[model samples]
Target chain A: MVLIYIDHSEKEIKKSSHEAISYGAAIAKQLGCSAEALLLGTVNDDLTALGKLGASKVHQLNNESLNNFDAKVHASLIATAATNLNAEVIVFAHNINGKAIAPAVAVKLDAGIVTGACSLPDLQNGFEVTKTVFSGKAFAHIKIETPKKVIAINQNSFGIQNFEASATVVEMTLPIPAASVKVTNVNKIIGEIPLTEANLVVSGGRGLKGPENWGILLDLAKALGAATACSRPVSDSDWRPHHEHVGQTGIQIAPNLYIAIGISGAIQHLAGVNRSKTIVVINKDPEAPFFKAADYGVVGDAFEVVPALTAAISKMKHNE
Target chain B: MNILVCISKTPDTTAKIAFTEGNTKFDENGVQWIINPYDEWYSLVRAIEIKEKDPTTNIHLITVGGPEAEPIIRKALALGGDEAIRVNSNSNDSYVIAQQIAAIAKQGSYDLIMTGKETIDYNSACIGSMLSAILDLPYVSLANHLEVNGNTASVQREIEGGEETNEVILPMIISCQKGMAEQRIPNMRGIMAARTKPLKVVEPLATNAHTSIKEFSLPPSKTGVKLIAPDQMDELVKLLKEEAKVI
Candidate 1:
């Protein structure tokens, strides 16, 4: 059996979990086995609807403590579920939570593990999986020799697919491990589109000149219903919060469309956003390194180009 | 208080990645190695900051690699680590490396252990958590801020859409990122002192790796960019709407 950890937030299941479920289902089909899902905490989303993502059953451990993620506790619970089910392969979405717990669970199960896996395993001769390495600059094919295997699928790498099936939901009562880490507070940025789940992202750099000039970027983001991000130096300079920083040293996102304005596209910054499906760069310098990586380029001053783009997008929306 | 900081040597960020031996091995011929930026800037520097705050604290650096990694360890010592430990092995498997670190950590009984969030080369982000599991201690990943008082530690890490502040007792493992501490450069005096620092080499515990690399490949090169005139805003909008369909 293939077991997938269904990642969720406080209110609902995460968008990346659907992709994990689909990936697991495809692996199950290849192995001629069943695909199941393990959900922790109490989620408001309908568990049965997850079947469309390809899981045949949903194993839920509804505990209040499980809501606030603790890596040790989560690893123990998932390891227990995997052992009980005698699963051959386990899957997780390579998100913040998955990155924290997957390795520990892999240690517990003594399973060969691969994180940041970008493609499915080739089982024709041996079980080999391809994963991104060197911070997304290259790929490496890894062969797993262990009988049990664990994989963390990269976000946005596997597209989610829906199938016609009804999954049976089962409630599990297990001994909850004591959490050594205690949550003192949770400060959240609500209302805006989250960078992790946003399909389109508009990011800026020092080229915006100062924080006061951020209104145009916000206007573009609002008009497109996209998230806002900035380069590392912008965050370091306090022009934006650290959470809005996206680069090798900051949050890594894989949105469908990434629009970079005034950023020079340093290699460090590219390491974080290079996974975006399409890149559009707007900068005054024609020789900016980012242009080399962009799918679409516009050589112009941000002061003039941004307002025009925003107005054009807003007008297009009105026409729609 | 005794703290253990794990570090790794990796190809420089600008190094050209290549393969050898029918694409089955990493080409190390012309690659320049350095202490991974995550390890140097966040993990080790944070440990140094804690030691500087408390005169009673001692910082020890540890890495698992062959002789080629000693220079990297010396660079870390110059940044303010008091001592170094090199586990004699050249394994790329994270599990094996964790087991070795766990053994050393168990013997030392250090108050805290730390490492970078992930190495740039492999980008596993697994060693710290795996060590925590083996040592049966609390673990935290992507710690942006950390404060230690007596036997307790307060850490703040990034979540999906927010920040989660956590408090854990001593004998914990943390993987650090940008906000943990600022990067430090070694001065001439510090660089001279690092030469005399004691670096102990130890044998690794018996272990086996469950995964092996089959080959290395590069991502397909990007197609050259299509430039549009600045005044061609309508044309850009039309392409996005009709061609790319992202909007």
Candidate 2:
């Protein structure tokens, strides 16, 4: 069995879980085994429906103590389940939660592990997985030598594919160990879509001038129904909240479309969003290094270009 | 309280990334090295702040690398650590590196163990958790704000969208990130003092890595940017819709 750890928060499943499911299912097909999902925490989503994403079995591990993510607890439970089931492969979404837990789980199971894996393993020859290295600057194909293997798939890399099967929900019971670390408080950002979950992102930077000029960026984001982000300088200067910052030091996002406006393409900044599928850089400076990495470049001031682009998108939406 | 902080030496964030030896190894030529930002700016600084509050608290730094990592380790010591450890062996495998750190960490009776969430180079983000598992310690990762309160600690960790505060008692591991502390530069006095600090180089334990790198490849570069004039908003939108299909 290939056990996929389903990641969730606030009673909702993250899209990354779907990718993990699909990826696990693909790997299971390669290994001629079954794909199973392990979901913990307080998710309200229907567990059985997860089969559509690609799991033959969905294991729901629930306890009052499992309300918040405790890496130790999660790792222990996952390792136990993987062991009990004699799982050939274990999978995680490689999101924040996965990064925190997968390593420990691997160590517990004494399994060879690979994180940030971008593609499915090449099992024909051996258990080899390709993963991002050097902060998205390059890729490395890693061969896991251990019999039991764990892999955390990079988000937005392996896509979702519907598996025409209905998964049976397995009510898993594991005594939740007393957590040494307790979540004292949770302050969640409401209303706005989280940058991590956003498929489309509109980000701004120092070139936008100041906080007063941010209306145009927000307007564009609103028009496109996309999440808004800012550069490290913008967040550091208090022009935007720290959570909106995306860079090497801040939140890293891999949206389907990342529109970077007025942000100089510093390597630190690029490290965060370089994994984005299609990057659109709008800047007045033709020499800005960002243009070299951008798929679409607009040599114009964001002040004028953004509002106009927003209006065009809004108009196009209205026409549609 | 003794705190063990794990530090890593990585290429400067702004350095151009390239491969040498036929894409099998990182090209270190002309690359500037720095103490990974998360370790220097957050993990070590937060440790320093804790030690400042309780002067009795001791901070020990550890790095797993060859002699190339010594300068970076010294830079970390200059921040405020009392002593340091340099693992003699260096490998591309993170498991080997984490294993070496764990070996030294096991020898010390520490109330706290901290490390950067991930190195910018590999972005493995696993050392703290790996260490926690190897030592069977509780861990809270990506802590943006950490405060020591007696033997227990309060840490504000960055979650997916927001932040959550986690409380842990003594003898826990944590991975630090930005927003944990203000970055501090080593003053001339501290730099001079770092030279005299005790830096014990220990031989690596016999450990086998579970994974090995097969090969490396760079992402295909952008074919070329389709530059559009500022006034061509409609055309740009059309391209995004019809050509890119991302809008």
Q: For each candidate, what TM-score against the reference?
A: 0.98, 0.98
Residue runs of model 2 more than 4 Å from their true location after superposition? none
- Name every residue pair that clashes in candidate 1: none
Query: What TM-score does candidate 2 reach?
Result: 0.98
Q: Docking category for candidate 2?
A: high
Model 1 lDDT at residue B147:
96
TM-score for predicted model 1 compared with the true structure: 0.98
Chain B global fold similarity (TM-score) for predicted model 1 against the true chain B: 0.96
List candidate 1 stretches off by more than 4 Å.
none
The C-alpha lDDT values of all candidates are 0.92, 0.90
In candidate 1, chain A reaches a TM of 0.97
Distance (Å) between predicted and true CA of A58, model 1?
0.5
Q: What is the lDDT of candidate 2?
A: 0.90
**Local error of candidate 2 at B141, Å?**
0.4
